[model samples]
Target: MGQLLKWLAGMLILASLACLALASWTYARSEAYLRSFERPPPFQLPIPDDEVTRARGDHLVRTRGCRGCHGDDLNGQFMWGAASAPGLPQLARGSPADFEAALRHGIGADGRALYSMPSMGFLRLRDADVAAIIAYLRSEPVIDRELPRRSLPWAIRWDLARGRDMAMPAVMNRVPPLRLEGEDSPLSRGEYFAMTTCNECHGLTLQGDSAFGDEAAPSLAVVAGYDEKAFEQLLRTGKALGDRELPRMSRVARRRFATMTDAEIDDLYAFLRQWPARTTD
Candidate 1:
């Protein structure tokens, strides 16, 4: 009996030691993975101080879901456990180049790759729009708020180290460039809006993604089933044809798409209606 107990104790100690080693390795590898991305070249855009530009920026920020992750006050907000979205107003005080790097490239001012930012969605944002966003963000007064320090869980770190999960910088690289350019037609404008906004929840192509598991978004091709009125209702009130509520889409639309102007909605709907044809090509 004594010999058996000694063996069990030894096994327990070995298991603990193994866990410790695995944790150490995960931490090191995760740090290395984060550091692997090369800092992108500095991007420059002239941030306009004019009210018209700033108002446009304000509209973009309000409708583009910027306040959804960041707090409504532009102060920092706690996201998932241990992760916090930093205060944008404070962060916006940085150079336009720094803001552009973060918005379009997922690169932080510190030259490190960001993790939670959905830069993949914003990768194709027009330079003028980006400049406006930076200008608006910088124009706001910084409201000081205490936020939890951002940290990754051991499981998430392990995933990052093993390449099971991609950091935002890596994900941004996978986003395709805009296909429609130069033309100012409604279709072109709509494509820009959907790619820059919808692609965050939908797939990078706006073809939909099951990555969110139960919250998976269906392809925008589903838009074909909805007439203009139904589509408008979905965007405005988060209701489907039968007034059926979608788990994620309902909430997102009410929060983000609800703020879109009638003209913008018309453009988006027009583009989405023709999305199936574009996919075939």
Candidate 2:
């Protein structure tokens, strides 16, 4: 009995040591992977303090789902286990160049690649809009909120180390460049909105993703099935054609798209309507 007990204890210690070694290796590999990304050149843009620009910034923040991951008050919130979304108000007080880098390039002020920030969606944002967002964020009063320190779980770190999951910087690189340019038509306007807003959940190309299980977003081509009124209803209420409630779409629509201006919605619809012809060509 004494010898059996000794063997069991020895095995347990070996298992624990193995886990520690594996964890150390994973941490080292993930840190090296994160450090591999080269920081882009400094971004220069004038952040306007005018009320008009700030107002537009406010509108963009609210309608663009900035408040979704961040709290409704724009204070920090606990995302998944150990991952906390930092308060934007505090972050906004930083340099405009840092803000632009994070917003468009997925690089944080600390020169590290971000993890969960969806910069791919915002990659195509116009410079004026980006400046306005920073201005509005800077103008807002900082609300202090207590939150846990952000940390990635071992599983996530392992995925990053193995390249099974991509950091924000890597994902941003995969987003295609804006194709429609040099025009102020409704198509271009709509493309801008959809690319920045919808592509976060839908694939980066707005071709839809089935990998989300129950919340898989269909291609923007599905919009062709909806008329003006139905699309409006879906955007406004999150209801589908038969008044069906989508698991994630309904929640996101009400929280984000519901705030879209009528003209913006009209423009987005116009752009999506051309999806068939656009895809064919």
Candidate 3:
């Protein structure tokens, strides 16, 4: 029995060592990936000082899930800090060019490709809207708290190395083009809005892309079943017509979509209504 126990302990040690080696390898590979990108030429957004532009920017931030991840105050948050993932950053300290780089290109103010920010959705954002968002961020009262720096855990590094997970910049680049080809109609406005705001959770194609290990995101075509009133209620209340629990969708609705303006909701609804028909046609 003593000899058997000794053998088992040896095996356990070996297994632990193997796991550590694997984790180290993944960490090295992810570090390489993070360092591989180069920043593009410096350019700036026309950040306006007007109250209207700032207000518009604030609305965009609120509705676009920025505050949900970053924090209600736009201060850096330990979103994943308590967990193993990286913390979201405060946006107010950067220049307009820095904002543009991060928002449109997934590059951080430090010129590194952002690992956590889902910039693909914002990549389609109109220039004016981007400018407005920057203006709003700049106008926000700076929160004085310091957040812990972001750090990916070993599991994330392993997943990233194995291609089971993708970095934010890679994901952003993989998204579909900002505009549908040869499309010029009021529907285009709706499409742009959906792509910029809804695509992160749904997908660039609005088909489905579940990143959180839940069931695949349902196609937005499901919206076809909803009338305008039902849809608006869902966005505002995060509840289905029958009070069905939507989990993340519900939480996100209250945080981001609850404040959607009537026109914005209508525009989103118009595109969603037509999306299924297009798929079938």
Candidate 4:
């Protein structure tokens, strides 16, 4: 019995050491990838502590899904590699233009475009709305929550190195041109907000995206199924049409949409209530 116990203890020590080694490896790799890119311009947007803008900004952040990865408190969260790629950074203080560049361009603070951010979809947001999001981030209490280090998988790295897959900058450069001609219409402004902001997960069509699967975001088209009050409830409380619970989206609504103005909400509804025209290939 004594000998058996000794053998088991030895095995346990080996396992623990193996785990430690793997963690260390992951940390080193993540740091290497982060250092590989050039940092972006300094963050310098004027973030005021105004009552109205703060409230509006907070709402904009929630509705846009900024908290999904950044943590409910706006602290950072480490996300592991999806499909063999190394994990990536999902949090940090950023300048307004830097924030704009990231959400709008999918680029990181260090100038290298982000590979993971869904900028292709968000590049549609209006300038003011984007500023509101930045304002919210700046206004919030900065929490230094420790997050896991980030890394890029060799396969993804190879793709970037070999030119098979584009870097974040290259991917973001593909954003469709913004065509907001005409006198300002409330519906048009609202549509622009939703398209650039919500489209990241809700799908380019604002219907749904199969690309994300279960991680797939819900469709705004379903909003037509709800009355104004019900729809407002969902956004404000994260509840559903039939009082059904929505775990992911609910949290988003509570944090972000809860701050939207009635006017903004009305505008948003007016735009989302209808479907976009289908396009041909």
Q: Which predicted model would earn the best TM-score?
A: 2
Per-model clash counts, in order, read: 0, 0, 0, 11
| Residue 149 in candidate 1, Cα distance off native in Å | 0.7
Q: For candidate 3, lDDT tens digit of each residue in 1-281?
A: 99999999999999999988987888888887876666656655556789999899889888887876677667766766332122223354556677777777878777666767778778888778988887777777776676676677777777877878776778776777745635866578788889888888787778887343345678888898899999999999999878887867888898888988898888889888988677655
- By TM-score, the candidates rank as 2, 1, 3, 4
Who is ahead in TM-score, 1 or 4? 1
Q: After superposition, how far is residue 276 of candidate 4 from its true place, in Å?
A: 3.4
Instruction: Identify the superior model by TM-score, candidate 1 or candidate 3.
Output: 1
What candidate 2 gets wrong by more than 4 Å, as runs, is 1-13, 210-214
Look at candidate 1 and tell me the lDDT of residue 131: 82
The residue-by-residue lDDT of candidate 4 on 1-281, one tens digit each, is: 99999999999999999988866665555445544555445445556657777676676666676666666666666655742111112222444665666766666656655677666766666565666666566656765455445546766665555456655555444454534435377767667767666666676666675233247777777776888888888877889888988867787677667877798777777766754532223
- Measured by lDDT, the strongest candidate is 2
Q: Give per-model CA RMSD.
A: 2.2, 2.1, 3.8, 7.8
lDDT of each: 0.84, 0.85, 0.76, 0.63
Cα TM-score per model: 0.91, 0.92, 0.82, 0.65
What is the RMSD, in Å, between candidate 2 and the native fold over all Cα? 2.1
Worst 10-residue lDDT window, candidate 2: 209-218
